[model samples]
Target: MTIYEPTQEALRGELLQRLAKLSAPSSAKGSVPHGVDSGVNVFGYCVNARERFARSRLPHPAVVVVLSGTKEVWRGDVAQRFPRGVPFAIPAGLEIDLVNIPDPQSGRYESICITVDAPLRQSLRASLNGLPDGPSIPGSFGIALSADLVEAYGHAASALAAPEAATAEAVARHRIVEILLLLSGTHVGRMFVAVDRAEQLEAIVYADPSYAWRVEEVAGMLGMGASTLRRHLKQAGTSFRQVCLSARMATAGSLLSAPGYSVTQAAQAAGYASRSHFARQVRAAHGVAPGRLRSVA
Candidate 1:
């Protein structure tokens, strides 16, 4: 099917209808179940009702397209709102709070988020290897939707709907690459071309938080000198110790929220030998005890 650029109102109406059709019926109030899985690590999101989830950290960089209603993303002390027809790019390895507010009239919020993985980044870098660099944009940007972007998203939705088709994956991959290329023209896109070494190190540590990670050991694993790794991390605005702590805390929070995991298990999974220390850290970072997370989860 051909993707057409519709008027903003028409686009919103169509996206909302798609969301309503995809949403599952459940008794749980304001719960966000999984939406579309594009089979290439990219997923789509649809919300039927307004839901306010607490602060959480996103481990990967994502492009969030707000189709209908609005969303509030809080990072540190700053809060930004993304309304319909806008796309927001979230940086990797940042702690954030998200609030998904549906349209008051329709009582629904619809959006799509495509996660950028290492393979996609490599693909993007290879594609832009010899291109003349454009004017450098900032590492961060505001959310705004354009006519081309809306049409691109509409096409993506269609491709996702029929994953069994031989061309579905190609279409999805192409669209993802297209989006990244458009982003690469901006300053923020430059950041995605090369994966941040510090973020890579953080992911390594996060995957196995129970392992005792040392800076020199991690540097060795990265095939770099300790001092060089430290320098690179400093440039990334963090240190080895900080990354370890952040990863552990984030893992602990996730574990606590999962069923069949006790506070002790969460603490252990986070590499905290001392339960009391784990509790203190969790309370400090999340403003609640580890036990509280289990109840909410």
Candidate 2:
């Protein structure tokens, strides 16, 4: 089927209109995040002003379609810039530094996030032929947002937005499946594979970054001995301390992203007692001072 590809600006305008209709009105400075509770399989997140965050961990394997402005993601030494109308796939438990730059005219940064959770991933594996069982290529990467995929995303959004609760779930699932089926053919499909040991540990720490976590305690939670956990981490080329610090910093970044969250509050949430210490740590890790993390001007 031939799908008409609209101009990127037109596509963004259409998506923004649909999103505004679906989402509640927001304050002047913050973000509006719509999810399953809003009866949609597709979620929309918009930031009114430019925002920068360090070590934001993605909890699930997902694809983010940038509808407007730009999203800059930093994963280790590699930096990827996703402009409007592009789709990028992210693996579960991956930590990334992000800069959300709003459009100069519209002054908003918006994107759609579709999570391919465990059940959906497994379902895709079972339904597809010749699915690989090996480990995924590390990190997130952008993929071509084909015209057909864009049309499929529209269908998925419509299905989830339908009024009939009974049929909405089934229809939404079907639409999502169609989108994923198309996505599976792309190079980014490799990211759909199993999560690694380091990812598992990172997720646990992210769940409660404020906790006083010890190697033995976390290892026990993962049902492995401390030594075994250390050995696995060694193979993964990371240590428990590194993972914990990363997760904590990610948690802090998330806290800092939202409006009305002071640096002190973010520090406390990330398990840091002193705000100065937290600021220093953030600068050391991300090279952006806490005070300069979110620059409105």
Candidate 3:
């Protein structure tokens, strides 16, 4: 590929600022970030706090940090609440729900977040390929972020507000490097998702749902004796039982919404041995029958 005159890092920084420009947080003084292009596209943006700030889902792998307010982040099954000095992750390919519970004494609150595009995964791996991994992934590596990372990201976020000619690109590139080291050390994205155990177990339960899966088959995927895996997940707030059921239910919902999937078909696609069991799970998760979701469109 032909290279641009500005180094990739320089370009990455500029793109990050541009991304921040495109995203409007609930508040006016959201975190403004600056950085170099680094040949990777980073969505480094900011948003301010409101009395009650809430945002819908956007597709990307995002890391958020609170600057001057407190906020709560909810994934499908996990909830994380943090104050102005910490960071968190919104993993790739998952729906996100955000809410900012204000500190009444302070009267106002704010937060800033940066989204690492799923495609940008390539750039990150390339930059720090040889470095030893950081002991932690400041923002959960798309799973969840830690409090100190929140503080550091809060500090890094200010770099976005810097003038374009200033530390904008350099600053963004710096944070990206920090994130890269964190991810490289993770052998398998073990810490990346806070979803249920069965859902987590699906990688081993037969990614191809068409295949049969016995309980032992699922347990083996976790690389532990069945009893041990069951015990560990119970302590971790998830279970393969719930995981399998929830995963099937989640999958059924998607297929049911598609243009050609009849309820019977969606049931089979989600690994239901029979339609009755599939419909039962659907009813439990959505309250309404699967048919209710038939496209209005």
In candidate 1, residue 25 scores what lDDT?
A: 43
lDDT of 2 at 91: 60
Worst lDDT 10-window in candidate 1: 131-140
Over 211-287, each residue of candidate 1 has an lDDT whose tens digit, in order, gives: 67788876765667899999999998999998888777777876777688889988887888998999999998788
lDDT of 2 by residue, 1-297 (tens): 997767766655554454344443444334344435222245667787888888776656678877668999875455889887667776655566888998888777777777766656666666665453221211236665556776777777776666467776677777777888887776456445335566567655654566677888766655679999899999999999998888777656655655677788778778899888899998887678776774421
Error of 3 at 155 (Å): 8.0
TM-scores for every candidate against the unseen true structure: 0.54, 0.56, 0.41
Tens digit per residue, CA lDDT, model 3, 214-250: 5665554444578876887788788766766655565
How well does candidate 1 match the true structure in TM-score terms?
Answer: 0.54
lDDT of each: 0.64, 0.66, 0.50
lDDT of 2 at 240: 92
**Which of candidates 1 and 2 reaches a greater TM-score?**
2
- Colliding pairs, model 1: none
Best by lDDT: 2
Error of 3 at 14 (Å): 27
